[model samples]
Target chain A: MKFSDFFRKKSSGDVAKDRLKMVLVADRSACSPEIMERIKNDIIDVLSKYVEIDREGLDIKITQMDGEGEGSDGRTVPALYANIPIRNILERN
Target chain B: MGEVIVITSGKGGVGKTTTTANIGTGLAKLGKKVVLVDTDIGLRNLDVVLGLENRIVYNLVDVIEGNCKTKQALIKDKRYDTLYLLPAAQTRDKTSVNPDQMKQLADELREDFDYIIMDCPAGIEQGFKNAIAGADRALVVTTPEVSAVRDADRIIGLLEANEMKDTKLIVNRLRQDMVKRGDMMSAEDVVEILAVGLIGVVPDDENIVVATNNGEPLAGDASLAGQAYMNICRRVCGEDVPFLDLDVKKGFFARLFGK
Candidate 1:
């Protein structure tokens, strides 16, 4: 977190390997970190038009769906699922 | 039947062709009939690396198109009697052969050879697909660099997706001094990240450049890279060879304690 930490004598191989692990995780989830952030913002914007939702408590994640009865090929399908907790429903009274 | 093994890396310049050439030659040196196949097509370099570029009268395309028999297309190695090369078509592109054709060719070659080492092209394209189509196992070659390791991971994922469950990792171009100085990833570090079985770790040696330039792989010599490749060939043949100790300058205490 310090300035010197950014310029530490860490090998380029370690840095790149860590970055690659992050990238592969994002790729396997079928989304990028930046894209995930955008999706969260866009969803909050859309939901703000209808109700008073707890935006801070909203969570969005992409996970692999277990293909139990999908012909037994043992391949999991990626699915995007989100949970947006609502505190109150706003009325135009 | 001959075991078809593809030497591939999703990234270029990671020594896929070199590894294929060396491993093929090493297997032949062990008296196993081995044929090295270059699947790079237009950018074929395996023959040049093996020093058989001048003897390439027929290529993979020629055999696939029924223009030449498989035996006729195979160029015998000058050093190893059992070693051969199926050079890729320089003028033709990757579209000249498909996965089915490659599989058929591999099946035909399986009857006579003990091992078929396919030098796969870089990138996860049609050529990579075709190279692994007929292979029962894959040796994913990478360097001690991050880009190479990342690409190897992607290639492994692709191979597993295609039902090629038997995959091993070969960490090439490893610099022991750099690893000792904590400036480069060690072979264990790479294997941990890739999460694959380690087949061999070839030290960075200048002799490889000279040998490749001379159209002769170093596997027949006593170079560091050659020994590593020879061990890889033995492992491929189901021999449990211990890894070479790259840290020759280890402290006396370290060796005494088996560190």
Candidate 2:
């Protein structure tokens, strides 16, 4: 991060772009925030059987990434990203 | 057979009617036989916009319901010899017609006209479906606002799902000054977000209001928006035309000052 970044004000276009990016990701995936929350809870329940994890710190979001394959034309495709903070593995004897 | 094109936007007040009027007249001016269809049904305004409201004896519903022949509803334009309008029924709503009826009407019109332009109503409802049913391609109109662009995106997705893969974009009411000041999204920004081929970019001009009020199209007129619409018409006909330089005045000023 640059020192000037903290002080520089963002343009309205920048704000619109950021908001549009997030909204479009959700729209394209047909997944709302509520749906994402349900999926997150399900993931936490399943992961509890194998390991101990920090539920509060875990994050899951739908975002966009560069598309691949035929006819992509450098367009972006929706992707699901998840970050799980693990504390320890459960020992199965 | 003629080409049917639908001028549509998911949101209202985004110039779909005006674009239809201008492009249909522009195509006629280029010597093609063109017919403009107002498919908005209840909230029909394309007739008023095209200055043919008084001549709407029979409307789309009249023809679809077999009350009148298709030729009876077609009102010839006052100025353009080759341009005609199939006005929508003011008394009827969108529910009076369906996609099958529209497709049949388009097929019937295809035998007579070289180009058929359908002015679609706002929203992704029955009206929109009816408008696009007979269209060979779509020209999705949108403003620079976030809401308009978002709706355009949704409309594009719907179009793709319906197997209408050939779609283009028209970014309307683009204010160059606001874009320069970073207050509004530019045409490039809109195109990038929509991910569609840009057919044209119409500048925010008061001449549009004057033209619409006078019940005339702005195509081929002495205004920036007119020229932009004309260019779009040519592009629709598969002709290669350069986009107008909206920065021309600023460039001229800079050249005069040698800056």
Docking class of 1: acceptable
The digit string of per-residue lDDT tens for model 2 on A1-93 reads: 558667878768767866786787777899867888999999999999999999989999887899999999787888878999999999988
Best by DockQ: 2
- State the fnat of model 1: 0.45
On a 0 to 100 scale, what is the lDDT of residue B220 in model 2? 86
Off by over 4 Å in 2: A1-8, A45-49, A66-75, B248-259
The digit string of per-residue lDDT tens for model 2 on B34-148 reads 9999999889999988998888799899999999999988999999999999999988899999999899999999999999999999999999999999999999999988889
Give the range where candidate 2 chain B is weakest over 10 consecutive residues by summed lDDT: B246-255
Misplaced by over 4 Å in model 1 are: A1-11, A32-52, A56-93, B248-259
Please tell me which predicted candidate would have the highest lDDT against the true structure. 2
Computed on C-alpha atoms, the DockQ of candidate 2 is 0.62
Worst 10 residues of 1 chain B by lDDT: B246-255
Measured against the true two-chain complex, the DockQ scores of the candidates, in the order shown, are 0.39, 0.62
- The lDDT of model 1 is 0.88
Listed per model, the TM-scores of chain A against the true chain A are: 0.57, 0.68
lDDT of 1 by residue, B13-115 (tens): 9999989999998999899999999999999999889888889898999999999888899999989899999999999999999999999999999999999
